[model samples]
Every structure is written in structure tokens, then in C-alpha cells.
Target: MPNVKSAEKRMRTNEVRAERNRQFRSRLRTALKKVRAATTAADATPAFREAASLLDRAARKRIIHPNKAARAKSRLTVKIAALG
Candidate 1:
């Protein structure tokens, strides 16, 4: 549907970026799920750390808001602590 050359290029770039952003978002979600599923203290610690890192990366890349990242990290930390 792109009629102009620049428009076509932009469309292609958009598609690529969209895929990359989707992958990053999915990865973050998976990490969060892992943290949520953690039943043991040892299991939860690394999962929480990984989720925090993923949240930070997503926020830095503008996939999610900074405050949202902080909130997620806080909740995950609380869950891990409550495991004890």
C-alpha cells in the first residue's frame, strides 16, 4: 500500500522494530511469570532479580513506564519476601 519509496522504507523499518519490540515485551512477561511462579526462596530470588533486570531494560527502551517498572519490581520483591 506504500505508494512512495520513502514510505515503503519506513514501513519496512516499522515492521522490524515492531517485531523486536514484541520479542522484548514477551521476554519481559515471561520473566515476570517465572518470578510469580517461584515457590521456593532460592528459586524466587534469581527469578525476581531477572524480572527486575528485564523490567529495567523494558523501561529504559520505553517499552514500559519507569514507574511501572519500579512498581513491578516492588511487587515481585514483596512476593519473594513473603515466601519466607
Candidate 2:
């Protein structure tokens, strides 16, 4: 549908970026789930670490808001603490 060459290229790049962002978001959700599903502090510790790292990366990349990342990390930490 793009009528110009540059427009066509932009469309292609946008599609690729959208797909990549989708995959990254999916992975981030999985990481969050892993942390929440953890039954023990020992298990949650590592899961939280990985999830926190992913959240930080996502925030830095503007995939998710920085405040959201901080809130998620704080809630997960509280949940992990409650497990102990």
C-alpha cells in the first residue's frame, strides 16, 4: 500500500520492530509469572532476579514504563518476603 520507496521501507521496518517488541513483551510476562508462581523464597529469589533484570531492560528500552518496572519489582519483593 505504500506508494513511495521510502514509505515501503519504513513499513517493513515497523513490522519487524513490532514483532520483536511483541516477543520481548511475551518473554517479560513469562518472567513475571515465574516469579509469582514460585512457592518458596528460595525459588522466588532467582526468579525475581531474572524478572527484575528483564523489567529493567524493558524499562530502559521504553517497552514498559520505568515506574511500572519499579512497582512490579517492589510487589514481587514483598511477595517473596511473605513466602519466608
Candidate 3:
């Protein structure tokens, strides 16, 4: 426990932010999984779009690196192409 009042408040805010980041990361993973689980290109298109949007959002928020998001999008594109 922090002896300072501001320190306690900071800790509380940090915990909330951490939880929010964790949930967003979880959503990103689920979105990626949905894209991978898709069997057909038509089926994957929408999932891929959703996953890409989530990835971009996460990257923009600095939850994940921008390069990581770009790489993932490229790989997903490849998978979609192969399916077609």
C-alpha cells in the first residue's frame, strides 16, 4: 500500500488501464483466430477485415507495434490469397 494519496490513485488508474489493455489484446487474439479458422476466402474476408481493424486500432493505441500489425496483415492477406 502506498503511503501517499496520489500514489494510491495512480495505482488504481494503472490497474484499470492494464485491465483494459488486457481485454483489447484478448479481442485481437480472438479476431486473429477467427480469420485463421475460416475455411473459404469468402468466409475469411469479413473476419480478416475485422482482425485488421482490431490490429490497426491496437497499434494506433500503442498496445502493439505498428510493424507487428503490418506483418500480420500481410500474412493474413497471403492466407486469403491461398484460399482463393
Residue range 21-84, candidate 3, lDDT tens digits: 9999999999999999999999999999999999999999999999999999999999999998
lDDT for model 3 comes to 0.98
User: Which ten residues in a row are the worst by lDDT in model 3?
Assistant: 31-40
Model 2, residue pairs in steric clash: none
Return the TM-score for each candidate structure. 0.93, 0.96, 0.96
Question: After superposition, which runs of candidate 2 have C-alpha atoms over 4 Å from their true positions?
Answer: none
Q: Count the backbone clashes (under 3 Å) in each candidate.
A: 0, 0, 0
Expressed as tens digits, the lDDT of each residue in 10-57 for candidate 1 is: 999999999999999999999999999988879999888888999999
lDDT of each: 0.92, 0.97, 0.98
Error of 3 at 23 (Å): 0.7
**Ranking under lDDT, best-scoring first?**
3, 2, 1
The segments of candidate 3 whose C-alpha lies over 4 angstroms from its true place after superposition are: none
